[model samples]
Target: MAKNELHIALVGNPNSGKTSLFNALTGLNQKVGNFPGVTVDKKTGSIRLEENFDAELIDLPGTYSLYPRRADEWVAYKVLMGADADIKPDMVLLVADASNLKRNLLFCSQIIDLKIPVVMALTMTDIAAKKDIQIDINGLEAELGIPVVTVNPRKNKGLTELKKVLAQASRMNQNLHARDFMNTKKLAPESVEGVQKLFPQLSEYAAIHYLINHENFPLSDLDQKAVEQVETVNKFNPNKTQAEEILQRYTRIRQIMQQHVVEHGPLEKKMFTEKLDNILLHRTWGYVILLAVLFLLFQSIFWLAQFPMDGIEWLFTKAGGWLSTTLPQAWWSDLIVNGLVAGLSGILVFVPQIMILFGLITVLEDTGYMARISFLSDKLMRKAGLNGKSVMPMISGFACAVPAIMSARNIENKKERLLTILVTPLMSCSARLPVYTILISLVIDDKYYFGFLSVQGLVMMALYFLGTFMALIVSYVMKFFIKIKEKSFFILELPIYRAPRWKNVGITMVEKAKIFVFDAGKVIIMISLLLWFLSSHGPGNRIEKVEQKYALLAQQHPAQADSLQKPLSAEKLQNSYAGILGKAIEPVIEPLGYDWKIGIALITSFAAREVFVGTMATLYSVEETDDNSSLRQKMDAATHEDGSKVYTLPAALSLMVFYVLAMQCMSTLAVVKRETRSWKWPVFQFIYMTGLAYAMSWLTYVIFS
Candidate 1:
């Protein structure tokens, strides 16, 4: 038999620091896309050692076994078998967390028995050491006939040794080159990169659909040759199953590991984790700690963002003034200043707020505290019969629901993942904060309750609590329909706490915030500009007549009009196109405690709920709000056309209830649609949420009136 070049695939469990190792080896040169039609993210990068010679590393999705359990696992297994690719791997780099070595080696043994050259990156060695579990790499290598390399990728340890070993392995591949292309042809160097780019992907859940493509997997030896190999040595083992090829792999790994590796010390963490988890996981105490953490998270979002947000606001406010002055005050200028500039600036202003949140979440995750949160929440989640893994996404829903839903792939159970995705939106995402703030400001008094919770603040907190309560109620109801035959295992590995990696945290915060600001900012900017231009220029005599009346009034009582302002122009009568629009919509919105100006704010705010404050400011014709002058003060002083109080208690209460229940933000809907891979769910979500808001607000109005 002619020898051929060997190809080794790198595989591991999720969060096993596999990507960290990949990144360290091939810094900044990583390419990411999807694994075919499935939304499972694929990232691949290669390392070049000294000369033109190189080792092509295929970083496969983290999976529990070689068994095709989930859509992601199927792709990973398909790629390794080369069954679908017309090429097969010659070897494998079985990276596993040393702390969780027992479960990790299950995949390694499967690869080894397949007759592939095996090398293992014993990642998180430091974590294992902290837990007082020492692995003898030489002993492991000798036992398995493969090298065992210990690595602390996060700390950049063992990188030099890893490079030396990879270079050596590449030469070994040269000897494996064959005479014919069929068996094991020498892989074309150029095509190696091309093949790496072509990630093994199948069409959607066709990989998982039982009623549809259950036989969709690429041909396997076990399917055709299992009966022929049933000799005395290969007697049928009860643990093995044909359902997904994972059980045999698991059985073999456990058998091999039983020969080596010893268990030591208690399973408890001795450091900050112990102290933290003790309070954090307590039945009652844990929830209180969670609330405390949330308080800091939300409070910081408002308080810490003040300086940066204000600075950005001022810069944008100045830019708008410059635009109005720099360009001709014609239709083009109106579009630029009102539609484009105004929209763009309003969105850019929120950058600081998104950054602050991104930073806090980065620190929380890199420190590995999020995993423990899942452990702490298992009981509570299971009360609704949700998977323990659902807790992370639910907590992440506090940050944003789109990603929380996208992340449900890590959840094994199909029903649990779907329910998590469905209910995650009920967790008050950052998008809802804008609506909550506006409604609270309009209705709830800012007066403190016994020196602490301001009624306005209390209203904001209630909105958050209501959203969380809403998720639980939905999950509780969904629990009856979902069938979970396999009990979820909360086998989360709490990595040893290290000092916060500020460099990594800073980069992550910047990346996340950049993505948020760039995407949502573009949408909001266009919306703001369009809304501005629409408000600035109108088509009819009604608008022209108001402008003529205002112009005449201004000429006669220019001083009266100058001193007539309460630091906000939008609240004034017909001076703003937005104000005029608000007035026009007032007859319909009056019962909701919203004047024409509030009506205008609500209309524009649909682009993003947070745009309410900015829209109100623009409509009010103010550059900024100060302590001596705020949007609430401007709104409170405004009068209806009949000279009645524009913002009465009933109207304010109705608006608050409306904002709390309504689906006003478009970005959230876009993300939900994308995550569900269907518009049906998001459409249903929007209709139900809006219906709920309308009904609740109507009830509040009737009762209060």
Candidate 2:
């Protein structure tokens, strides 16, 4: 609201390079939060236009035109229409894809006609150049009556000019008398005039929107009723008016393009992308290539992350050992070394894997292979009662289910979107990566095939495949029961292949890692400290009795005190408060080859699946004599009541299966409730996912045992 600070809205069509441009301008000074009264993500950032003068840029969700369809699109539409009080931009920075000029211009023209000051940033000029197309930027700007800049956000080109133009435009007087892109008043003069009478400040085009989208606007009851009366009296036809407006805009756009744009000739030969797509998107070869790509992606996660993960584990182990030895023997010392350090290790050790996974996924997205995945999977997705759009959210679920489910908002069909949300959690997210890795290390051999193919890596891939397979199966079954019959279509735009933006991939990796460590780390540390207290202390004087008894036994067998210490610690842990709680649930999970300790982990991990490792770290650290042992080693050495190994193949496999299916994340449940706008779906999600996990885990344990 400062006099010198300008509030600019970044608007564009999907794939118009708007996000990249925002990144170039703002760099690391950005934050994401929800828009007011909606769950759609609103990305805003601060950029310094000059000394002591700054601009706040709001990156609106991509939309093709002012007309809104999805929830996210409506967010952008409202902001541009000046109906959203929370974000009324002083000017609009419209990003347009130069490669698809005609279609992009439709949106540009609409924004221009809104009578707001605009600075159009033309992107994808390289792609346009590939098609032998040329544009006269000055001529286009002159015709459109707005400043235009060609920006290559990937290479950080033309951003200086963009900022300069934005600063100049911010200082200029508002030009309300600029020529309209088309004669919007002619489309529906009576309705436009009536709408303008109620809101005197609206442009002819803005009034047209008020006549049509009044209900969607944030208007009071009286105003809404008045707009309804105007519609009734004028006999306004929203669809007809919109169609006529678009036709008029495009007609004007064609005239402008004829003068300022030139296409050299039809493409004489297939481009590299087209030739490459023939092999990559071949019906027979596409699936094979997709599988091969996925196989490498999974394998690389373990291969690439092993060194860093081991280094992190070693650092934490050394740090814990150093703290334990350096500090005096005391309760707080044990808490610091065994509780906080141990728990933090469990969280940070897997960060390398999380980063690598997201970095690779980003590369796929940047290279545009991700869209091809959707295109290729449409048939199978449709068979599962979903569409191609569902593929993106399901794939995104590999990182986290909360955002993955949020991304489902883009799916147009309500039934399909619901189905996507319900089933996406089945996909193995990065949080489960820690659990999966530790368990696989415990149970699966480190043997390799052909000197490179790791058995452990193959098992990791199998877990992901299992989750995806189940998601499809669940979606197929639920589609019939939901019974909200609506026709669906899969219209996907596959961008031409380009080299991955290494900078963006790196940024994504760092951001995802920070999110994982900071967000998940908080819960892990709290649980670790609490679990430490629970495992160390017992109800009433039971802990004191156990300590006294151990003291007496050690005195009686002074020479054997070292050997007796292990049993003494074990006895205390069994009689502790945590022990009592875990024992209460032992019988329930005992059928799945899990003891009270595992029972305790299962309960606490409901907060977050990754917390399972932190819980184990704390529980085992309480009794561990060797501070140098890693979590995997400590877990592997765990024993049952009969002195049998605790994490046997059956038990490890059962735990992995449970995590793969169980809806253990409370955050995911909360998001589902908000998204569905009801508790009914989240509640059902919990029951069914838990039920399936239990049944499958039990079956795995029985068969393996």
Candidate 3:
């Protein structure tokens, strides 16, 4: 290792401001990937410390303690015990919440006893002050015998001094506790001594952990046998030893707090957060507010993103026209003007909605209301055979299912986690926004019911809720089939409410929008090109024959040339390869009120739901060669051979309902496969969701037609 470079691990309890500190220190210099053999998120970043010294910071998952109740906590334990060589840290940066010192210190003290070089970074001191609490940092540092620094990462405070302290701490020798906090030898002398005989370098705390979880710990066959033998000979009682050790640690922590901390008010001060939570978490009123918040979110997705979406469409339309008139009309020119420009336009127009949605979600998180939402939904989650933690992943599925599925790793119960992963894709992600918006505009009226509420936005909200409702139903059904019998519970911390951090919110919005465009954009453009080729050519001379027929018709009647051109081109599309495939599937989907063109879009959009619009855009651009209208306009004016409208209200609604229930995105399936480590679940997921989509869509069409 370089002298200036070191590896540091960040560990703390949930809602301890650990992630905020990491974000402040790393800013946009971070990368997220999975651990070596696990699906848990591993966040690493580069940090520039004092005097040209740099460090690699790994942000471990926020865990309550080192007892390893969750998979993520086990990752932390493995690294802290120097068992995971790939991620073992040179030093540990333990973050403690000053407002809740007693609970936070329990985990901090455990880290200190691990005998690793460690520094304590105290956070939320300002919040503590609001509660009339004060901490003597110097006194606490002397008591703990480690370097301590105060930092408010949200405000970018104390970071310089923190780096300097870390640099100085790194120069010192390895941290070995000269005085033990709890004399484990007195509590379990034989057990500790027997374990230490095998690994003589084990710290007091490390030895105790081995006593509790030696079976799960990293050890070779021979080493494990020796440890088991020691445990057997020593008559180790893990439950009694763990309880005794924890009580002793808490006793010392209480003494330390009395000496180094001060409280200036009564315990129940009716703080600001409590006052706000009263209204936000009220039994009846809380549900009302949550509904209102969701309504506003969907309303804003349409109200705020409309102008930009229109502007993007107009710009692309003009660009396509310009390119067509300026360049010679050739195959490549057509590809550039029609295929690529049309696809790019379809993708870019949705960026505004994505940015707005993610920005508002980030605000919700920063203000600490997101946790309350999770808390309030725990009842409903339990009813669906999941715990409160599943709510976050389900809500996240509205953005994307890939990460939402990955987020389920924290759920300790195997059955609940698998159920969460299976049904999460049923939530309407942002990719489906374009499809719903276009279809709603095509059939639904824009007039408000009560003069202020948008009828269109209401339909959009209905589509989202429809997805969520079906997810819960599917999960309830799957619960009985997945036989893992572990119990489920929810333990969430509601952090103190604070003003929204606009900087963090802005960064999140930008990053999320970038991922949507670049990641989904790659799949969209490639599918668009493939659809273009498939729709442009047929299996034989049929495509050329159709074109010739159209040319001859236009030649004979020059006055009716413009009127005949669109139908002639539509005829050619019906004979193209894409048209043949769509026609082949048309019989299966006809009961759902879809025609061949809509069928084509459905087939192409399986790569990504958002590609539905691009497929429609390319197909329309091909059929109506002289028409330079926006996608919605073309879709709105579509008519059948007998002059009846193709996209009637019934058909439009059926399409929306189908999309709500369908599992069309291939990326989601890939993620499910990766997470479950089997092809069985993803296959079952696709069949169930698609079956439900088809059945519901058929029923909807039957009722409305």
Runs of candidate 3 exceeding 4 Å displacement = 1-4, 264-268, 307-351, 396-414, 429-462, 514-522, 540-572, 608-652, 674-677
Better of 2 and 3 by lDDT: 2
Assess candidate 1 and give its lDDT: 0.64
Could you say which candidate leads in TM-score? 2
Q: Find the candidate with the highest lDDT and give its number.
A: 2
lDDT of 2 by residue, 1-705 (tens): 333378999999887888788878887777766788776778888988877789999999999999877778889999989889888899999999998899999998888888999989999999899888899998998899899999999998999888888888887885622688888999889999999999999999999999988988889999999999999999999999999888888888899889999976674577788999999999999999987987688678778988998899789878987897899999999899878887888678778877887788889988989889888888999999999888878876886776578768778778999999999999998779879988998889999999999999999989998999999999999999997877776766788888887877877777667766765567667777887888788889999999899889889989988877766776777788877888998989989989898887887676568777766875675443334238788888999889999999999999999999999987678778978889999999999999999999999999998
Please report how far candidate 2 places residue 564 from its true position, in Å: 3.8
Ranking by TM-score: 2, 3, 1
Tens digits of per-residue lDDT, candidate 3, 618-657, equal: 5675443334347678777888778888899989999999
- Candidate 1 regions exceeding 4 Å error are 1-10, 26-33, 45-48, 51-59, 83-92, 114-118, 130-134, 174-214, 218-280, 384-387, 397-409, 429-446, 475-500, 518-522, 537-596, 618-630
Spell out the clash pairs found in candidate 3. Answer: none
lDDT, candidates in the order shown = 0.64, 0.85, 0.83
Q: How far is candidate 2 from the true structure (C-alpha RMSD, Å)?
A: 3.7
- Using lDDT as the measure, name the better of candidate 1 and candidate 2: 2
After TM-score superposition, the amount by which residue 122's alpha carbon in candidate 1 deviates from its true location, in angstroms, is: 1.5
**Segments of candidate 2 deviating more than 4 angstroms:** 1-4, 326-335, 396-415, 429-464, 481-487, 518-520, 607-656, 665-682, 701-705
